[model samples]
Target: MSKRPYLIERYPPSDRFNHWFVAITFILVALSGLALFHPAFFFLSHLLGGGPWTRILHPFIGVVMFVAFLALALRFWGHNFLTGNDRQWLRQMDDVVTNQEEKLPAVGRYNAGQKLFFWTMVISILLLLITGILIWQPYFAPYVPIVLIRVAVLVHALSAFVAITGLIIHIYAAIWVKGSVGAMTRGTVTEAWTRQHHLDWYRKIKKGEIRGHDHY
Candidate 1:
């Protein structure tokens, strides 16, 4: 019998590092942003060395996260773009929910859920960046009008809320899916996991001769 070919060399070293970078920075940003947003949320500032430091670091950390996440998203955006198969998969979500892979649709590197998440994150990040630039205190705000700054703050907070919620869901999905955390941490998943959760990706990996680090 032939040996099963190794697959799931999907996330590269930089890709994994980029993901953790964004994750960690976003946590810092969210906590700091919340601390400043409301008196009730002041406790969050404690995580970043009190309110004054949190305020100073929030924007800095946010910019770092945005740049890193933008690069990461650009790297994977083409692969994660929605396809016909993804639409079919969404329409047949019942099968996916039931884990009936044979009866469900064939997905590429990313599934419909993942594609949705990818776009959602992209839009919110863009919104956050634009709005943040508008109300960044000293730099851009002085040049912009007061009304616009108020509007930007509203949009910024709303986008942040949405982005945070999506991130929570993304984390939950990663945890729920077996072998997914391994991919992020170790930059690879098991052959069985590749075949089961992402068969189309598995096939392409084998055909394209992609193999995991462990294979090397």
Candidate 2:
């Protein structure tokens, strides 16, 4: 009989749910935000309701996304800190793009690029939240000076642009790397997949240093 393939848990159900929840809310917030950003994209407001309703719901959706993302960030932050190996990984960006992972240092649970992206999201979200409140209408903005509100609006737009751009790259990378999306969607990864992309993590599991839900 052929031996059953080994599988290792990557994300638990809670993590998966948190990730998808943040993702869905992010899409809603981004669409509604863009609608309010410029007339050219105003048609996107229809996704929420109409122009007035979109304005009303956009900030609320943003708050929900922020809260969900905070949970995800806290859960994964430990895995994403930069290390000596991660620095080396960043230095070998050419090899990364060339699919020459074998030529690089042993990768851990999260890679250098992934770590950078994680921090970028963290910073962007914080900036958006703070600046968003400063410019928020009918509540907080009234108490703030007009000049500060103007500055906040500018910063908010720039931060949102950076965040949206980063998200596009994140999504593209997920699609580019085979089995990555499965790790989030199915909550597990094949041993072969883990060994290839995150050999250090694979080794830890094999040595029983790192425990994961197992299937065979």
RMSD for all candidates, in order, please. 2.5, 0.9
Model 1: per-residue lDDT, tens digit, 1-216? 887656457688899899999999988898899999999999999998998888778888889999999999999878787888888999888887777878866667788999899999999998999999889876788999999999999999999999999999999989888788988887877777877887787787778755443573
User: What do the candidate models score in CA lDDT, each in turn?
Assistant: 0.86, 0.93
Q: Show where candidate 2 strays beyond 4 Å.
A: none
TM-score of each model, paired residue for residue: 0.92, 0.98
Worst 10 residues of 1 by lDDT: 207-216
Clashes (backbone N, CA, C under 3 Å), per candidate, total 0, 0
Query: Lowest summed lDDT over 10 consecutive residues: which window, candidate 2?
Result: 207-216
